[model samples]
Target: MEVEDQIRRIMEGEGLEFTELDVHPDQAKPATLRKTVSYIVCAVILNDQEEVLMVQEAKQECFGQWYLPAGRMEEGEAIEAAMQREVKEEAGFDCQPITLLLIQEQGPQWIRFIFLAKVTGGSLKIPGEGDQESLQATWWDRVSPLQLRGRDILDLIDSGLKYHQETWHPRTLPVAIPCSHVVQRLVLIFSNAEEELWVLLVKAPRLHLPTAGAVKTHTLMWASSLVVQDALGSLYYDQEVTALGVLGLQHHYHPTPGRLQSRCSDGVCFNMLAQLVPDPVQRDRDGEKLEVVPPSQPPPPENPRYTWKRIQSQATAEELFPTVAPTSHQDGQRADIGAATVAPQLPPRPRRLRELGSPEAGPGAPAAGHTDPTAGSSVALRPRTRP
Candidate 1:
């Protein structure tokens, strides 16, 4: 219930939903760094004059071109450590991450953590005194002509600017807790036309948020939809599952230079809010659009293992059910409907995969056991170490 309360307060106050992790302390997958998954970290740094920081590429492919100070995360290293290391190596500055500015996912296999960081020390890299990391680093005035390695960073720079001027999203960073794989602790929500909202919870796990492990082939967000499909079965096709954004993240890696290890130790877990909406294109046997029945509540999930818990707190419900103008994919036009959305139909159902939680195998957090914090945490128990 502590996890539930934590989620409730955040939703009721900030419109950000916190989810209980589906990841247990210990799991079956080795999830070792570099071997199973790889991550890229990007830094968005700005000066008092609002010039963006840029680094010249030294790597063979994009040599001489400019890009953000970014690089691959090394084995068993924390997210912040990786970010700072990249900045120091590529940009020649010591920095601290203020908050997670953005997260770009290519699925379970590839992920990028973007941050807005402020410099703490070190001078900018110059052409003569640099290693293979880069030729030089400088703050770009935006108006200056610069050859860019990729234009994809243009949006990342803009996101940093928007965040610097005024706070839009909540301030979020990776917590210290260790996880074994790329997993999601999801706040899955369903609502009616009347705006009443219900959250999906796992029944056997003592009524906690549904957690899903990432599949290598699919995007990280697809894990949430996979949860819906498993819970709803045949009804999945008519539903749309989309992950809104991350609320909390966990990453931990201890640096031991000469240590020989049996497995890679890097792990990160993302806590996110995902939505399940009805399919807009519902048709009857006569080819006429059908009015989705009982616009008052969500349909029951077919699997008894999952249940929809109605949010009694109106404040929390409102946060969970934020209003966004629905759009049509058919003609790319505005959806002509109220908040009460239609229900689902899947063109193709993804195969059911096992949940990430399993008996604790090696070291670190143990397997799923109890909710009691007194017993233990990081292994066998849910996270009570909320910072």
Candidate 2:
């Protein structure tokens, strides 16, 4: 399959990926429900009147207070499915996720998926209809005189309104590939000075992109560099790994309800773009020869279990690699801002995905509306302000 097309499919919930934690399984703490990790899904739904969809707390600690519809994800439940279930159970309305608006995390162990959703059908659950899930559901104007479960959701509501006003990133939803643990599905790439693109793939089980498990000691994004550091050995520090942005996510509830979920994994797989970036500081430090110096490529890994496959399709290459075009100055001189000295392709073009900067997003999280970077596993998630 074409490389870019495969990614598109994954984003649309039509594709699947195999976990590669076996490559260095010891490096991660795989998801095992209440054991290694726990996932929380929160929904932020807004109505035409600019009011927010909210439910009164049913839990004794905060009874009759207002909050967004959210709940603990079941051991064997899809992320979106869990969100929908919570919305219905709490709000008494059917809803669908528009996109994953934010990711908040206390590391991957305690993560929350926040989404901007739309009410599809159903009436609000009135007072008597309240059950253990909620006392009642209602749409509240931010200015209304309502007591809240917590003030924290104020930021979340604002975040939702901001996204409703302007969409800062692509429409991202969960990919439905079954996984037994939490992993980062890497579109890990290395490029030559000529912009010949290649992706890293795990050779075992099947020839697929590498999926690194999350190590609780560090944030999930660290998984990419960890694998690189392990596989590349001495070459690890010569180049930097740039987390471009999250392309999509994969999650599904695959275990039987009421069954102990400890045996199976209910973690998410973040499909992301991470590139091995070579440092340019020493590009001319080696010598003062006036001759134009060509850049060096990261050497192939000595590990036989890993392989780099070149991208032969030009269209696929462009989707993965950012591009720069010449723009004319007021003086009529055209200059290319990208570092590449050549006509096209290579690293450090302008980025469209902003860093979410969530600790869950880990390292180079984009500030745009996104997760897989942190709204994010960092999704710590002081509600993210839209850039």
Name the lDDT of candidate 2: 0.65
Off by over 4 Å in 2: 1-8, 11-13, 27-30, 58-66, 125-132, 143-159, 162-171, 191-196, 203-206, 255-265, 279-296, 302-304, 322-351, 359-387
Candidate 1's error at 101, in angstroms? 1.0
**How does model 1 fare in lDDT?**
0.64
* RMSD (CA, Å), each prediction: 11.5, 9.0
Each candidate's lDDT (Cα)?
A: 0.64, 0.65
TM-score of each: 0.77, 0.70
Off by over 4 Å in 1: 9-28, 255-265, 285-288, 325-387
lDDT tens digits by residue: candidate 2, 1-387: 544566546534454655457446876665777678877788999999989998998888788788889888776678898899999999999998998866655446667778899999999999899899899988898887999876656656776786688665556777655666778777777777777888877676667777778766556666778777766777675666766556677775665566555434576777767777654444445655344334455557767777777878775666666332212122112221122232244444433332233332211122334333232333211111123
For lDDT, the strongest prediction is 2
What is residue 312's positional error in candidate 2, in angstroms? 2.4
